[model samples]
Target: MESITEEQLIQMVRDFIESESSAPQISVSSSESHIDSDHHHQPSNIDTLEEMIWRETTDVEVEILEKILMYMRNMGSLIIEPKNLKKWVVLRLKMDGYEASLCKTTWVSFPGRAKGNYEFVDVITNGTRVIIDMEFRSQFELARPTQSYTKLIEALPSFFIGTEEKLGNVVTLLCSAAKESLKESGLHIPPWRKATYMLPKWFSENCKKVSFSPNSNSTIEEF
Candidate 1:
């Protein structure tokens, strides 16, 4: 299969979100008084998206995932495992007494195209099934100093860094980690749509410097 371009990747994800959002919700009829004995909780939209995307595969997906894995290994302690066909644990970032589970999902296949199977990333936290929207693509800007941490910080409730000062520090650390990871992975992000962005207006005055080195500071535990 041909490699999927980054724009195609982003477009695929956007399309998937739009399609799922537009889908009509199924309602149960009152005539059916009893639910099935084996009925289970319905999966979230993200779960459905993941399942749908995982059905297709491509060389681009492999290349993208490999880059992410290389970058993750340099960041901190990680635990990698396979969950199943539609889902699996690629990396569990363990640091600051918290864990962020990163997985591959959202394989992009156009409505009628079969060769373009691009994948996207999702992060989950410990003891929870909710997918934290990092808004990575929304935050991507090639000209800025990557600021991909708002959703991540909000999602990581277990982490102690919450104050404006500490939060900015953590954000900076994350941005740096992302930069290093992408660099090491040799991923070519366009100049106009780089994975990083300038600090938001609010962060301009609140950012505080903190000592954080993914390679030197954090311990590594691979599984």
Candidate 2:
């Protein structure tokens, strides 16, 4: 008898599944199907959460992903915790004339009993509790997982409706790499991408300029 290789084992599993319409009875899902008295006896927050959001992936990364919150620090506009958005910024270079997508995610958390998970992201973009809604659309662009960036125009939404009244105007900035970056050895961002700043905050006195680490409390994620 010959031993099966990794590829062969995978193929065998695929063939077995195709031969059988149903999967092995590992555990019943409380999500993808109707609840039965027998299988519904399980306990899991994420299980019920899946039904609440209607999606399998509602995860938000913290160690690095938490940086998305910094955008709120320098904004001059407001959305009053009821909106969500994600935008595409840059693209990774591809032969098909492709680029990685970039964007940000924001929302405020609602006051809830279960870990207070949902409310934080909602107040940020007005999403209901347990949901992580984003305001800037640029974070979703790149499927790659890198960590470095500098100099770009980003949006600043209001926490409360009509925040621009006190915030003045949103603005962009001329930038160097993140504070701990090595680009000083001659940083090379695209000519079209480098910028000084955008207004109405550009004309403000309090908005000071400073170099930040690529990962320094920014809206961009690991990739």
Candidate 3:
């Protein structure tokens, strides 16, 4: 990726902020409608996990998440592929003066895990790193999910923007719950769904950071 000049970055930020300011504010309760209609009947554990997710989110993360949501609402239709969408999001975050990058993580097969690679975005502010997964809830979907597990999945956000530690905690909690849910339904838990396997998709040491530039080709650096 080529580098964008400071002047260009400033102009982009100004335009984005102006457009965002004109848009109507979104209500927090509006998201509740996306949940399953049966959410009211969900078990206590699902409620606990939902509470934990929000409780761990910091103010900075929330602000960034709102920008992301707005961008998706206004400009997402123009982008068709997931990779391009992520790249655009990184550029937008940079315009907002956030240290954001597109990260690609690849892992080799281990004794009990399969080889796989994944891509997502991350932003650093005030010495804290936050992971952003646009496809967060789908990662936990099962072909034949138990009613309980389905309820749990419904409680998750379609996109996640939070600290790495909090994400890890969520993975652990969800994976454990998944195992139990599957067991209750006489189904076997897949290795890919285990916390040990899923965690590396974001935390792997083999991550490559791709920096965006508007004027030139993007550059990749191994982390």
Candidate 4:
């Protein structure tokens, strides 16, 4: 398979932005056919989410996304476990002169939430911080989805590289949509899927930052 070039990945982002701006038409009949009448009466949350995700890309975000795309394309030959991939990506970014780290966040069980931990990569460029999730799209997928919810999922990028503010907005939109989709299907929404729980996965104050030195074989520091 031919590897996707950085230019190609950047073009894909541009195309996605343009497509979102134009609001591509989605086919609803097939997926909505089995939905309940109450679902049909609900407001269009997916449409609102689609509009929310479409915004002008910052220079920093584009640069980071492009670099991540290149790194991912080159990683195809390596074992692609999430832990190793995240560490590798962080190392690569650091070698390229960017401040990158692996962030692990853990929280205890609290009211309306459960105890859990999550890990992801983040980079700081020119004093701006951006969250990078290699498995972004998969996080929002549902077993059974209404047509509108499916459309919203389709619009999400496979990987997410953006600021905390943008990520917060995305979590809010997707979680709300997910709740509505589950309600429509007569299923319970998993606690982890809720925005309140999901947001802390990245935004927690208790997060530990781990950094790797580019010149060392096993030099890792945590703070």
On TM-score, the leading prediction is 4
> What are the runs in model 1 whose C-alpha is more than 4 Å off?
1-3, 32-126, 129-223
Where is model 4 more than 4 Å wrong at Cα?
A: 1-54, 72-82, 218-223
Residue 168 displacement (Å), model 3: 0.4
lDDT of 1 by residue, 83-193 (tens): 211122222222332233333222222333222111222222343222222233344222323233233322222211112333344345545544554565566543322
lDDT of 3 by residue, 105-157 (tens): 99999887888999999899999998888777778888778898897787676
- Candidate 2 per-residue lDDT, tens place, 1-223, comes to 3432334323433432242233222355667467677666563332332222222212322211223333333222332212222221111111113221221222222232111111112111222112122322132112221243221111111111112212121111112222123244344433222222211111223332222233344432322
* TM-score comparison, 1 vs 3, better candidate: 3
Off by over 4 Å in 2: 1-40, 44-60, 77-85, 88-223
What's the distance in Å from true for residue 22, model 3? 25
lDDT (Cα) of model 2: 0.25
Model 1: weakest 10-residue lDDT segment is 82-91
Please give the lDDT score at residue 208 for candidate 3: 97
Instruction: Score residue 60 of candidate 3 by CA lDDT.
Output: 81
Clashing pairs in 4: none
lDDT tens string, model 4, 53-130?
545457898788677657645543344333466787788899889999999999888988888888999898888898
Cα lDDT computed for each candidate against the true fold: 0.33, 0.25, 0.72, 0.75
Misplaced by over 4 Å in model 3 are: 1-43, 73-80, 217-223
What TM-score does prediction 3 earn?
Answer: 0.74
lDDT measured at residue 169 in model 4 versus the true structure, 0 to 100: 86
Candidate 2 has its poorest 10 consecutive residues by lDDT at: 113-122
Compute the lDDT of residue 101 as modeled in candidate 3.
93
